[model samples]
Target: MKNIQVKWWLLLLLIISTTVSSCEKEDSGNAGRLTETDFMVAAANSDLFEIQTGQIASGKGTLSEVREFAQHLVMDHTTSSNELRILANQKKITLPDSLTEDNRAIRMRLSGQSGVAFDKDFIEVQITAHDEAISLYEQATREIQDPDIRNFATKTLPILQGHRDHAVMVKSKIDSF
Candidate 1:
């Protein structure tokens, strides 16, 4: 009787292990591809970082143009964040609440500057960030498998390009000064 009980327990364990392994295999297929959840979380985090850095610039920048750009960043990114949140909710995705570690470090560095130095650093950072954002959106629009996210990326690329163009103009002005 005890031997029979042990055999049954072993069989159950074997079945459970097999099921779990198959599930894992299915879940991890195409590990190189970016998932929808990954895209959404990354998008949300980017918005948060931009908004935070823009707030810092608005408070610390001495240049009127820089302050105005910062305000635009805060407003535009905030709207994008809200739209992303609604889409994530509709899709049952949970986005992260804070910036990534790298972005937080950028924010920390930006927070330490003042006056013209702050304006230059802030504009430089914005240009780099916007360039990255444009590239990211372009990649997502081209490569993302999820249709909704791909569409979102397609719609966002133009705005990112505009921001990058504005940043470039600002950098040219700064160089002339």
Candidate 2:
């Protein structure tokens, strides 16, 4: 009788442990899914970086082409940022109001440059930033579950691609000089 009781207790404990383990796995799976909030936060950060750097480039760039490209970045990213803000407000997700620490550092570094050096560095920065933005938007389009956010990502990818191509062109021009 005692042996049977011990066996039954062990079985109950084993079942409980297995059930608990399964529950943990399910919870983790849900946590791993890409959400709109995550995409928005990252998008907001990217827009902020673009806008700030563009502002600097517009003022400090030696070349008219570089200044024009900077102006374009500021205009487009400002519009994108405003739209993101509206979406974030609707979803009750507070988007970041400023650049990330790394971006702030980049801004500081760019601020210290002037003339042709500034234009070259600014174009390089834009190329790298737009590349990152394109990747983020592409990933969001593929992995995000929210229809609105996925649509936004899909729509924005082309713009990011355009910016990257323009940046590459600007880099070539700067290199030729």
TM value for model 1:
0.79
Q: Give candidate 1 regions above 4 Å deviation.
A: 1-31
lDDT of 1 by residue, 1-177 (tens): 999999999999999999999999987876656678877888888889889999998889787778888888899889888988988998899999988889989899988889788889889999988877776777677668878778887887787787778778877877777
Q: For model 1, give the 10-residue run with minimal summed lDDT.
A: 27-36
RMSD of each: 5.7, 1.7
Q: What TM-score, over all chains together, does every model reach?
A: 0.79, 0.91
For model 2, residues 1-177, the per-residue Cα lDDT tens digits are 999999999999999999999999999987766678888999999999999999999899999999999999999999999988887888799899989999999999999999889998899889989988998898898888878778888988898999999999888999999
Q: State the lDDT at 130 in candidate 1.
A: 85
Number of clashes in model 2?
A: 0
Best by TM-score: 2
